[model samples]
Target: MEQQSLWEATANERKERQALQGEQHCDVVVIGGGFSGLSTAYHLQRKNCQTIILEKESVGFGASGRNGGEVLTGYIGSMELHAKKKGLEAARQMWQLSLDSIDLIEHIINTHQISCAFRRNGDFHAAYKPSHLDGMKREQEVMERDFDYKKIKVVEKQDLHSELNTPFYHGGRVDESSAHFHPLNYALGLAEAVEEMGGTIYEQSEALSYRKESGKVVVNTNKGRVIAKELVIVTNAYSGDFQKTIKKTIVPVESIMIATEPLSEELCQDLIKHDRAVSDTKNLLYYFRLTADHRLAFGGSGRSSSKRDQENLFNNLRAGMITVFPQLKNAQVDYRWGGKVGFTQEMLPYMGQLEDGSYYAFGFAGHGAAMSSMAGKLIAKNILHEGGGDNPLEKARLRPIPFHSQHAKAVGMMKFYMKFRDRIS
Candidate 1:
């Protein structure tokens, strides 16, 4: 399969659109033209709602453009976490939703005929330490019994090391229903599909302000404004000052990644028997996978919600990658990039209507890509009142931490605590 390099995959495949110049009118205004915004606008336009997507930068410029490209259901749901909030039965449905998100992503690729190296091989979550394996085991037991999720299977040290070609992993949990692909390509493809469906996309038209007048919300960009009956905030962590309420509601986490020069076919095949992405079990972990070109794109993105020193986040992440995949100690790093991910205190993705026609969907916890794309559809469904496609999560509320200080000290303290924990271990 011949394709452009992973970093540049979406370059040639993007659907270019003119930026918003002057005042414009659209039925719905979608902020942030990434996966969440693009998919939402695409689906909304398909429903014949005259829609316009307002992109802060180019489409796929944020996390949608930069992510581990790992599609898996082990992130399906946490029984422990869900049980604490919504109980066991609701958690079971949450598990199904995670699995459904995986299926929905693949379905979009097939139905839209998007050529983003879409594959259904599977994904592996490996253990960085012995304790991590226990967490994996707990995950396996509850998911299998509660949701009848048989797609997940465990691989012991011997089998995992052989398949992963990494000595640091103790074992791994494999999910058959998940896969990986070029994320930016997928996001750009979704935007293209939206245009094909007669939707208008306005790039570089950052939403700087919004005024809710009457039933219409006027979205003001630098050069233009859209008076939309409904508005969707799909910007995630990049929402910026367009909406102070949204900006204050969530925290942005910095994620870093790197791409390596192409490897020998034999070496690539030896590294991963099949074509699935792998992430380890660490608070800050290493995620990597083989591309269609036989090169390895490993993720070592460190997160900083509030601004902090980023002088050497890449170098630290690369060092972490070598620690996990020591075999790649000498691999030539080709591209290093970073982006932000929004997270809510609840750890569940915040999805709900802010008002009658205004929707908020961000905070996909730590996993977005496919899940964020799924969220876009949900936003469209709620706006269109097509309740069938709207699931139980349509009404999920935001649970903010009582004391989420933005001084950046909160994360710094967490980092200090983690370092101490590691030292103790």
Candidate 2:
């Protein structure tokens, strides 16, 4: 399989924007150009904020471009967990925002005329084990009783074949509100809209460092610098050395994906009749969907960042894909790629002001596609001093993960434990 991602290979191209050169100034300086950064800039531009976006690479060069295009609903973990930890009201608010995030994506697509092949045909949460259906039942009940969400429809084991061609799942739950699309295309379209609204985006410019002085935050790049009233860091998994504190709050976990060569329309239909994005229940889950070109895009979790390990992971993903759909045993894989996703202890995205008074957002777990957009909007609202006192994600402070320096080892251990549990259960 080619190392390139299917999204990268199939996305529409856009002209490269110039990197930061000489000193510049804006009302807000966004430190990343992925979904969160571009979404923040896009919303800020609507408020007529003089925003400048600095990207180390092209837009969507990070997880925004590399993710499986599953625009799923709710936080990464279950709503019951959120309620148990954050209280029921807070959980309800977060639940509503999760739903709103999907709507926001649809609104942006329609308003901006983004041709990302978006579909709202819904998504399915397949029960990888028969016992997994009990958890799905609890989730469905919580959504109805507490969250007031009624979109989930549970399918029994005998009827599972109607929803999925696989014999792997015992049952499944379908959420008609969830959707999927071309993630890279959506990011590119958002970047275009940001530029159209007079927002400046520097493609190759990286935010090396930033300091607050004289009521302004000065962000310095390799070639230039940006001075602004506020700064927003939406770097996600690429936070790196920019801000060690923010980096420590989340662990970057490896996730890999493969796309099969375009199949016959008849075959595609047979593989997934309803064409809803599907994911199985597991700590290390396999999520997949059909691309607009009729290729099955299958992806799953991984533990290593090395190129050799990535090749192995790709092979493992192919095996997993074939396990789900035996007909794909001989199908050719066209593309294979992997990237790190920011995983937080809470399994939820967080957006708030740092101790330095600069605003930030990250740790979307696996919900970055839609939650990151909501993160952007919330960050913009907070920056503009708009009303957002009710959103739980917008906190007054962020806490560093305990023993974060060893997070790589910790994540590996956790993945092993989860895998063992999956095997036994």
TM-score of every candidate relative to the true structure: 0.90, 0.96
Model 2 root mean square deviation, Cα atoms:
2.2
RMSD values for the candidates in order, in angstroms, are 4.1, 2.2
Report the Cα lDDT for residue 158, model 2.
95
Please estimate how well model 2 matches the true structure, expressed as its whole-model Cα lDDT: 0.86
Local accuracy of candidate 1 as per-residue lDDT tens digits, 293-332: 6778887546543334454676777787777667677889
Residue-level lDDT tens digits of model 2 in 96-199: 98899999999999999998999998999988877888778878898899888899998999988788888888998999999999999999999999999999
For candidate 1, the 10 contiguous residues with the lowest summed lDDT are 1-10
- Model 1, runs deviating above 4 Å: 1-6, 74-77, 303-311, 355-357, 388-390, 394-425
Report how far off residue 263 is in candidate 1 (Å). Answer: 0.4
Top model number, TM-score: 2
- Clashing residue pairs in candidate 2 are none
Error of 2 at 191 (Å): 0.3
